[model samples]
Target: MDWDKLRIFHAVADAGSLTHAGDTLNLSQSAVSRQIRGLEESLNATLFHRHARGLILTEQGELLFDATRSMAQRLDAAEARIRDSKEEVFGELRVTTTTGFGSLWLAPRLNKLYEKFPDLRIDLMLEERVLDLPMREADVAIRLKEPSQADLIRKRLMGVNMRLYASKDYLDARGRPEKIEDLSHHRLICQNVNSTQVSAGSTYTQELLTYNIPSLLTVNNYFGVLQATLNGLGIGVLPDYILADFPDIERVLPPSESREIPVFLAYPEELRHSKRIAAFRDFVTEEIFEHRKNLHESGDT
Candidate 1:
């Protein structure tokens, strides 16, 4: 088995498309196809069941892929160890977090991290679905709740509460709600009760829904809800961390809030010594400290 051919085959199989694999490998489609053919001939087996959509691995290909996948993971582990031996934080760091925090909080503050580690590349994956950290789906994760995944080194970064907020202009026009019952006459914006989110947030949203709000705007993510609130659409339920970025948004019915949701930073236990992880973890920790300090000094706490 030729290592180069196997590598190309692995890329093609992983992507499920020749063009995508070619793009990643920096090779032409013809070249990738030729390598796959050569690999098939060398092994005397039809590796892929080709169709109009894409290729599917055959029984033999599945067996070969299992071996190649193990080889690739081992290689990645060896590379991570090699990189950890160096002090420089220069490599791709895949970080995952909720769309709300990643977009509204972490992404804006990443420039400071970049300023320190000028050569670092961050791949920010914003989604609600938890990635498999132990499987290398993401290098690090900042989540609204403590990760339940085992074999992870997790730190509780902070706690955030979901609260009602609206644009100052909107509140000035509609008048602020003095109590939860008063909210029935105003437009309430929040994540859909069915959306994948922290249980605390979802529970709070469900409770608000029972108030018979005159108008409702439900978004799947807080980012959308925030945008709508900023537009003066309605009072939105959002995390407290956003106050640092959106000063114009005023908290409404200050006493109305969800149970505090803990923010956590976690990484695979195997990456305990990784310099990249350490750099990212330290940078995020510093940002949170600064955020807290700013809120205190501004009298916004």
Candidate 2:
């Protein structure tokens, strides 16, 4: 099996169209098609079924896709490591982060880094879904939770405190809840479509029973919760940094029972010693640690 042909096949599978994949790789459509045909011939299996819409992967293709993706990622990482050894920070820094944090915090800070090192290209991937960093999907990942994988290095950058907050108008109309039991009477905004446990053997659904609040609005994204809270829809439990500038919003409950989401900087264990990765990791750690108190206080607004 030729690795180049496999790489082209993976690209086509990922892009879902020969034309799209060809554009991505700067190859002509004919060249990409030939490569895919070569790969299929080499493997003695039909990888994709052609359709007017796009190419659909066959059962054999699906299996090969999974294995080849991992292999391709490792190969790319190895090349990156080799290039880094030459003392040039000229490679791309593929970073994955949650939409909210990437937009509100990290994006702004990255400007200074870029200004300092113009050769260091940054591909900022903003998504709610966590990317598989071990497979080389990203060079660095800013995760809300600690990485449990044994081969990854996890650094706790800071703790994000979630507080219950509501607009002054909503509180004035509905009245403030004095105890956890009183929350049952008030309207609440619930985030997380499928509630997962933050810790081992723990379930968020089970934890929700403790609050026992009747949800007025359910949103999948944290930004949705913030918008709803701002509109005086209901009280929302959100990270403090998100609400820092909103003067109308007030923290309804003290820090009791507040969930602390630990922010972690995760990367492959092997890339820890790389100068570029080390520099970025240290810079982010120092900045966040210095502003930890401010991040907590910002939510009270």
Candidate 3:
């Protein structure tokens, strides 16, 4: 099989138009059409059904597409591995992490790493939703939850303690809630507009108490919640590291009462041998573990 022709087919299928595929592949539309025709003749199957809107994949094309996507991804990974072998910490490192961790901690530390390895390029993708590692959506991920998927290689970074905190102004205005039961009287701020993980028959309201807050103002992102809490909107349940820099916000609850969120550095098991991933994993472990004290002490916990 001609891999080049197969690549052109894949590109056309992806773009849904020969002209767009040609634009992507830096070829003429007629050239792209010729390649597709050649691919169909070679396979002896009609890969696409032409419609007024665009080319729709035939059944055979769908099957071929599934296989081709996998093949292309593996080929790209193989190329990346070879490129990584030829260099020392030089290549794009795509990483996904939560907003709080990315902004407060990881973003700051990455500068030092970049300084040490100038050749390396880093892509920090900050989002609450974990990227799909098995599908190769991201090269690496720093997550708060343990990855249970069999194909992922996960390393525990540290056990992060999440505690309730409030600015002095908010605490003074609403007064302190000495017990968990007293929380009802004060306004609480909840982060992440959508609930984390809803179990069977659970409502949106039910998940709030799971984090130990009932009535509250909810924000869609972590930074919004942090800023709102700092402005004395209400008490917020946040990771200890996030509150480290804000001296005005005091920990409302003891460490024993807080929730322990485990942090993990995860990558696909297949890419475990990649030098870039190994370097990042080791760098994160060394940097975070070595400065664990400062991270903890910076917070009220």
Query: Which candidate comes out best when scored by lDDT?
Result: 1
Candidate 1, residue 278: how far the Cα is off, in Å:
1.1
Candidates sorted by lDDT, descending order? 1, 3, 2
Summarize candidate 3's per-residue lDDT along 1-301 as a digit string, tens digits: 9989989999998999998999999999999999999999999999999988999999999998998888887887777778767658788889999887888778878877877778888889998786888777789999888987669998899876656778999888889877766677777776543555212112322443655554678775557777888998887766677655677888885642345668899998878778888888888988876567666566443
Tens-digit lDDT track of model 1 for 44-129? 99999999999999999999999988888778767887888897889889999999999999999999999999999999999999
Worst 10 residues of 3 by lDDT: 197-206
Predictions: Cα RMSD each: 2.3, 4.0, 3.5
On TM-score, the leading prediction is: 1
Off by over 4 Å in 3: 128-130, 192-194, 197-215, 255-258, 296-301
Can you write out model 2's per-residue Cα lDDT over 216-296, one digit (the tens) per residue? 677665667778998999777666665544678888767533456788999998887777787689779766754665555
- Each model's lDDT comes to 0.92, 0.77, 0.78
Q: Which of candidates 2 and 3 is the stronger one according to lDDT? A: 3
Worst 10 residues of 1 by lDDT: 72-81
Return the clash pairs for model 2, or none.
Answer: none
Q: So what's the TM-score on candidate 3?
A: 0.84
How many residue pairs clash per model? 0, 0, 0
